[model samples]
Target: MQPFELVTVKDVPEAIRAQAASETAQQGATVRFIAGGTNLVDYMKLNVETPRQLVDINGLPLNLIEPLPNGGLRIGALARNSEVANNKLVQERYPVLSQALLAGASTQLRNMATTAGNLLQKTRCMYYRDIAYGCNKRQPGTGCSAIDGQNRMLAILGTSEKCIASNPSDQNVALVALEAEIHITGPKGERTVPISRFYLLPGNAPERETLLDPGDLVTAITLPPVPTGAKSLYLKLRDRASYEFALASAAIVVKRQGTRIDHVRIALGGVGAVPWRSLEAEAALHGKEATAANFRAAAEAALRKAHPQTQNGFKIELAKRCLTHALTQAVA
Candidate 1:
């Protein structure tokens, strides 16, 4: 919305240099990288994000979806969501990831949204977007209006007094469950960070969302090999059937040996500040009989630490039911 300088670069090194040069020239000015401008453009129109310089990285060679030597997958950051969801390899190996992607926004938006951009999408909290209200994420130390305002869509777990906004990414929940790793390149070089540690809780500093450093660009996401014959499911519960954000969603991957559970991973969305991984539930279900009673117990263990707010109390029960249903579906 504001007048800003735009630079399009062909390669990763050139893009990094362009961003660094912009920062050096403008002193304290902000610089943002644009791939698929679906989310950034909306924030820019509202003046929520006011980056003085934009570096377009669409020309970079980061749009491939390739298979690793160890049977895993490497998804480029620029790969569109629709492409990843419809890719035969993704649909065959990681159906949960594909299901999560399809359960997200409409087909039109999915065709334009990139993998890295989707991971970096901001919270949809009304207070954070509206400039008239005070928000710790939008403006640190100013106070969070969502604390006492309309917080039905806010988080119930991993929430702090400063902020209760939820991480609204369906793909991220699946990634957290699958233990995906993020590949990032910056001025110093390149590094890989596990998906579990990528997102941060809204502790005192809600403004700091991810572990990405200044001038760092995400290159790809790597998913480790899924166990053969593993059963995984992603169940989303929203106010409607389609084109709606989840009120409570569950991503469960279960490996069963006859009647016993060999391994299990559970990740929850729409109920936490970050993609909520349930290690407690996994521990309870491990080496146990995959039964309805055991599933209920696992669901209870997962929601044990949930602290619900005034209007979002129903999320506790909703999340439990959703987890139980997802587990049943995974086993079935």
Candidate 2:
């Protein structure tokens, strides 16, 4: 690991001041604000992230789970994954979220991982994991080796010729299906970015992962209320159950009548640069009859635009099966 300084702050304001000052004081100094350090520490150990200073923000009171006026939930950034999953309100209202979180990592790691950190976790690409390989995400303009190389865990949507690394978060996939909003704090003040727009695609620059600026902190996440007869589920397919990463997964929220689909929201994981929302599939399902045939057709429509790699062509069919299964469960 690289040599760096550590600064401990008493509050969020002080931590913000320390980060802003560091950027102004040192030209090349890189600073990272740590809360739980579940993801950051792992990356640091892998030498994927080397910061000049580590600002501890665990002092901030950003870990509360408050209920909104609209019968929705507002989850703090510092709220641990396990805490949120076990929260009575969250478990009752957003069972899909709870199931997704529980499916991720282990009980101990989930206790240390925060909502913000989970959302900010980097991709799990093999080339990005190895320091020897040239990855554009690790170092911009260096080039992406996963493009023509072995890429079975890469993306099928929002990918570019430069990078095709998949975003690997089950929680985010559930959040996307639930249509949650992310609240952030920065120098310019506070702003809310919808979970849909919070993550950027690899249009030309895959290095820019999120819409966050320097020293910006995620404050909370809010979920909107849904109508009655709305069913939601998160289905993850992996090599094995417990600790393995997803090969392909689907999060589906469907509002249905007796035998017809009213509204449907679908987001795919392990197959996109971001939590990929399948608008085409959603459109195909809405106002259509809910049947196995329709679900299969929608799944195909969702993956029609997929660009698979040499080793990952199987993902196309795998993802389709997962989506169809998720849709069936949501209807059930």
Candidate 3:
């Protein structure tokens, strides 16, 4: 990694001031925030990220994991993945999130990775990592090499002609399924963003990943209360059992009333430019019978608009089976 000025901040406002000087939150941001440094360091080592200044927010008071007054959960931005996953409240109430955390990197990574770092995790696309290749995400307007190159592990759902890199975070997939809200503090003031509006599709600007501005510091994420009979789980399908990213993974929360499905929230990872929340799949399952056929139909509805690349056409069916089986187990 190249030489960079590191500034440690004790509060959110200080961190915001340090980062707000950046022009954009795009790939070439000269100033950036660093918490866990697990993902950012990897890119820095590859020279994929060349930030001139690093705002370290580790000393900030943002590591709390507690219950909200409304019976929901508030996960601080700096909360360790292992701490959140093993917490009694998270294990019992948000098992899908817990499972996804455990399904992420490895035990060592889980212990070090923070909530905000996972929130802003970058893709594992090979083309984007290697500077020799042309990647719109890495260097905008140069062209995406993965469009016709090695892209078996890239995205299929949120593909534009410019980019097809998959979102590679298990924690985010579970967050999208739970309809969590992101709390942020920036130069202007504070704001709350719904999970649906958090990430941007790689339509024209693959360089800009999330809605985060240059100075925006993620404070915490709030998850609303789960429904009464809601059953949640995470299922990850990968080439290996550990130390590998998901090929297709599902985070499902299902609630059944008698024989009819009342509540359903579906989010898939390793399949889209973002942690994909399948409203179409949820629509198919709402008030429907919890039968194998219904689950199959819902899975089909989820992948109806998939735009598979040359080598990744199998991901469409693989994602479908992954979601269907996850839904089945969630309801059962």
Candidate 4:
């Protein structure tokens, strides 16, 4: 929306150098890199972001998906959402991820969206999305209107009084269930964050969202090999079926040994600040005889700590129902 300078970097090193120089210019001075530009451009238009310089990383070798040695997949940051979702290997090995992707925005948007961008896409909260509203995330120290406002789509976990914005990516929800690792490269060096730790809780700093540094770029996402990922299910409950954000959703991967559940991974979306992995729920079902009672108990354990707002209080029960149904379907 505002005037900006565009610089195209030839490689990762050059991009790093450019980022450091820009940071030295001023604190939080507008500087960002563009990949697909679908999310970034839209945010810029909304004035939520006003970067002075744009670095293009379109020429980098961060666009390929590689198979891991341990029978898992590592997805490059630049791999288009459509490409990754439609890949035979991904579809076969991580059907829950593929299903989540298919349930996201749209085919056209997926074609233009990158895996990294999807992870970094800003919250879809009406207050944060609109500049006119008082959103602490957009304008720190202002206020969060969604706290007491219409909050049917807000969060129930990792939320403070200042902010309740929910992470909007369906892929991240499935990644949490799969126990994925995020590979990041920055000025200091390279570091890996379990996708679980990539997103931060709103604790007292509602403005800060992720653990990424100012110039850090996501390299790849590595998913651990889970025997049940192929048979997993991602169930989304919303006002409408297609193209709508989830009011509550469940990603369930269950591995059964005979009639007993050997391993279970559960993650929730549209109900938390981050992709919420329910260890309590997993513990409830792990090594237990898979049954309707076990699934219901697991769902109850998962939602026990949920703190929902006035309008969204139903999310606790909805998430429970959804998780129960997902667990049943995944085992079937």
Pick by TM-score: which candidate is best? 3
What TM-score should be assigned to candidate 3?
0.99
lDDT values for all models: 0.91, 0.87, 0.93, 0.87
TM-score-best of 1 and 3 = 3
Error of 2 at 148 (Å): 2.4
Model 1, residue 23: distance off in Å is 6.4
Residue 237 of model 3, lDDT score: 98
State the RMSD for candidate 4. Answer: 1.8
Q: Model 4 TM-score?
A: 0.96
Q: Estimate each model's TM-score.
A: 0.97, 0.96, 0.99, 0.96
State which candidate, 1 or 2, has the greater lDDT: 1
Give lDDT for model 1. Answer: 0.91
Q: Could you report the Cα RMSD, in angstroms, for every candidate shown?
A: 1.9, 1.9, 0.9, 1.8
Query: How do all the candidates rank in terms of TM-score, highest first?
Result: 3, 1, 2, 4
Superposed on all Cα atoms, model 1 deviates from the true structure by an RMSD in Å of: 1.9
Model 1 residue-pair collision total:
0
Candidate 4 residue lDDT tens string, 119-164: 8888999899888899888777889999889888999877898899
- Candidate 2, residues 1-332, lDDT tens digits: the string is 77878878877777777776545312323788888797778778888888888988887899999999998899999999999999998877888899899989989999999999899988989888878899888877778999888798888777888898999898999999999999988878889999888898987778778888776878899998767668888999998889867889999888888889988999998998999999999989999999999999999999999998888889999999999999999887
Report the lDDT tens digits of candidate 3 across residue range 122-208: 999999999999999988899999988999999999889999999999999999999999999998799999999999999999988
lDDT of model number 4: 0.87
**Where does the lowest 10-residue lDDT sum fall in candidate 4?**
20-29
